[model samples]
Target: MDCDLICNFKKCRKRLNANAWVSIRKDIFCDDDGSREFNKSTTCPACQTSLSGTYDIIRVDLQQSEKYKTMVLAGQKPETVIDIASRALAFWTYQITQERTYQEFVTNKGKERNIQMEQYYEQILARTAAELTALKTQLAATKKELESVKKKYTEATEQILDKGRQYQKLQMLYDALRRKCITPLTFDMGDAPVHMPNRNPSNFDLTLSTRDSILRRENNVSVSTTVPRSPAEREFLLTPGPTPLPPTISDECPAAQSRFHLHIETPNRAMSRPH
Candidate 1:
């Protein structure tokens, strides 16, 4: 049969050091030496009863025992167990504290760096915005100026074109006037009559000649005189024919003629004219 027991022993040496019968019984019967028998008789150390079945053994170590003793001793105000164990615990505690401190410092520094970077980025964005605004303003002004210049240029070009056209028109008029002024005049007249000087007379005589008489007269050399006859005969023979009038006269007319005659003649001759 199997016997089961539940017991807590601090250490193997602690059980040995108790020196009590009960403690020895607990160590010898419940520890490594304990056993359960079903067909044979296994008696209890104190009561001399058969051991129970299905017993369990529990073991402990010196380190845990010493640790508990030190805890207890420290509570009881003893300094004997204050050794490497306490030092190790203190070292672990200090390490954890230092780690927390470093972590906090690193976190604060990261936050500060992030804040500085944000500020720098904000400044850069502001400067870029200002520059962009300035550029846009300049571009607008330039565009306006370009439009003004283009308008002026168009006006000037139109003015130049107009002047050029006017100059061409004036030049054509001048050329036409010059051609008219420089052209020479030509006259043509057929044979008509020749007048004798000082031929004006109220009456004169004339003779009619036939073709036979003209032939006889051509053969003869004789001077003949005629008597004064009728007015018709005189007018037909010796009357001064009407002087031909000038076909065209200048608009300046009398003044221009007078001046021309004055220049051509002597002063006495010009003064002798009728007023």
Candidate 2:
């Protein structure tokens, strides 16, 4: 009952009452973990101090100690032994109680450290998870913006190509007219609503005149026509009636069953605006 030694490691709950290790610092530990720690560093684990080799720690046998103590006190007088016994018994009793108090202090310190460590790790984890979620949202938004820009780029490219083709066609038409290779397609100035010649005009026979002041003064014709070399031109030559849409004319140009639009160079109107 006098001995109540235990391992100094706060986490270890092993008893060292029978046989144990005692360091110069008076720190006590159990046989198993104590020996292992000593061999690993040859240092005191509790104080974090260097040890002066194996002399710093000593193996103690409590049963042998008590037997030896009794033997040494045996040879003395009964009264002398009795008086020394009282003081020695009290010393050992208080020493054992002090060791228990120190164990409780170490255990409490270990618990507080564990709690603080858990709190710190939880805060770090929550912060990291939030950052990960924000990054994912940003990536999704970036992808959407990229797709929108790509769609607008494709539409602009198509519009540019359409305009280029229209310009080339106008250039070729102008060269042919200036050379006098094309004959004028006649129109009725009388009550007839400007008859488009019934026959499909050949390349040399197709002609266009403008409604603008300059062309009006030069030629006696008032109405202008855009005669394409394609079959769509003959469709216009048909007498006024219901007409079907042509594949050649697209969303770029608007057309009605009896009328179509053309881009002609003039002082005011370079191209017709879409309705």
Candidate 3:
């Protein structure tokens, strides 16, 4: 029911079994079966051109039309030059389409990445500006607070110095008063005996000494007239010490107290003795 057909075109002249030929009757190309109905058309496999009535159709034994059988019997058949060219053109077209698609994908992806990077940079700049503004505000507040603290410190320092000056003035006045109180008293017992006939007698020599000297009456005799040398000594001059009480004044009269108060209790001996 099938035949072998060859293209009549001298430039092509490719041969193929009827089953492998194009069929115009059904508008379907080659099929696996070799059911060759009459009036079926075919094209040259190399040129893809119709060779319908122009080609010769030779009746072929079914067993001989089998491709594997033909190959085994005839070894290998070489493809026509046009067939090789056709395949090369098809492969080239496919490669071109695939390359164009890949290029489009890469270009679109690059554009999207660039847009995202620009947006990210803008966001970063905005955040930085806000943080910078906040820092400036904080710095200004800190400066204000520092100035306030400095003012308070200056006022406090001035007050402390003023109080210290007042304390020093008071201390100097107290020392002056104590010095005046200790000024020795002078007496003139002209041509009279310095001694008195009594159970207790006056210890004063009745002789004139230095005007600024101190006079301490002890055992009815004049004692030392030493004066304070330093401000510390003057301050401590009135402080009571662990010295023995005068026998004549056992009730006790501290030197510092007597100097500052201007009041000294007369010794018991002086009070009891007759003048």
Candidate 4:
């Protein structure tokens, strides 16, 4: 099936198993292209050799052995010519064998690269699975911690509500006692009425809203607008912290509760006032 004897012409690559035209320069051509080229010029188409009357372009049968084959094998020439022909045949055979081997090597190299690519993909897949498992475990732990914080917040809310109810009941009792002090009820056993002790012993009210309403307010100090021109105004009361700023001037200042509020440039200490 393979065309071992093909036309040597560049444009005519057809098989020439039956008969072919051969030039003296060893150029082979098919019947149709060769006849056209020969008629067009007496010179050889391939090498430009003069082909006048002699059979420079001869027709040969490839299927049958030619008469020239006997002349070449009968050692019609010197031994050096035979050796040169043998060397040329050996070089052509070696080149053909190497070409077949190189094609198989390339094919095997492509298959090896495909296998390596598959192995790299599998490694990436396994790493992704491991990372996903760790993330899922971290998410579960976060959910558990969130539930614990929710339970603690709920318990604290209930405690605050109970304390607020207790404070409201104590405030109602204090208000009733203070009102009783204002209006006296006496026993008429004695001629002179006896005075009861004042119910509000602290003097100032517990709530700041009651005292704030009694005092007249003044404009607040705007730190951004106030520019210090004098040395005394510019002088800052530098205190080592973490202490707080000074308490504002009020009617209830220097009271038992004022010790907790007025703390600028003062060291940390408990109230020295009597309980």
Highest TM-score against the true fold, candidate: 2
Q: Report every candidate's CA lDDT.
A: 0.48, 0.62, 0.50, 0.59
- For candidate 2, the lDDT comes to 0.62
Instruction: Order the candidate numbers by lDDT, best to worst.
Output: 2, 4, 3, 1
Give the Cα RMSD of candidate 4: 21.3
Among all windows of 10 consecutive residues in model 2, the one with the lowest summed lDDT is 185-194
Choose 3 or 4, whichever is better by TM-score.
Answer: 3
TM-score of each: 0.38, 0.40, 0.36, 0.33
Give the range where candidate 1 is weakest over 10 consecutive residues by summed lDDT: 185-194
Q: Which regions of candidate 4 fall more than 4 Å away from where they truly are?
A: 1-103, 177-275
Error of 3 at 109 (Å): 1.9
lDDT of 2 by residue, 1-275 (tens): 53465677767856666777777665777887778898787688777777787577888776676778778777799899888878656645655776768768889999999899999998998999899999999989998989998999999989899888777766655564543333442221222233334323232242465434333443434224444454333332325675333335456533321133433334223122222
Query: TM-score of model 3 relative to the true fold?
Result: 0.36
Clashing pairs in 4: none
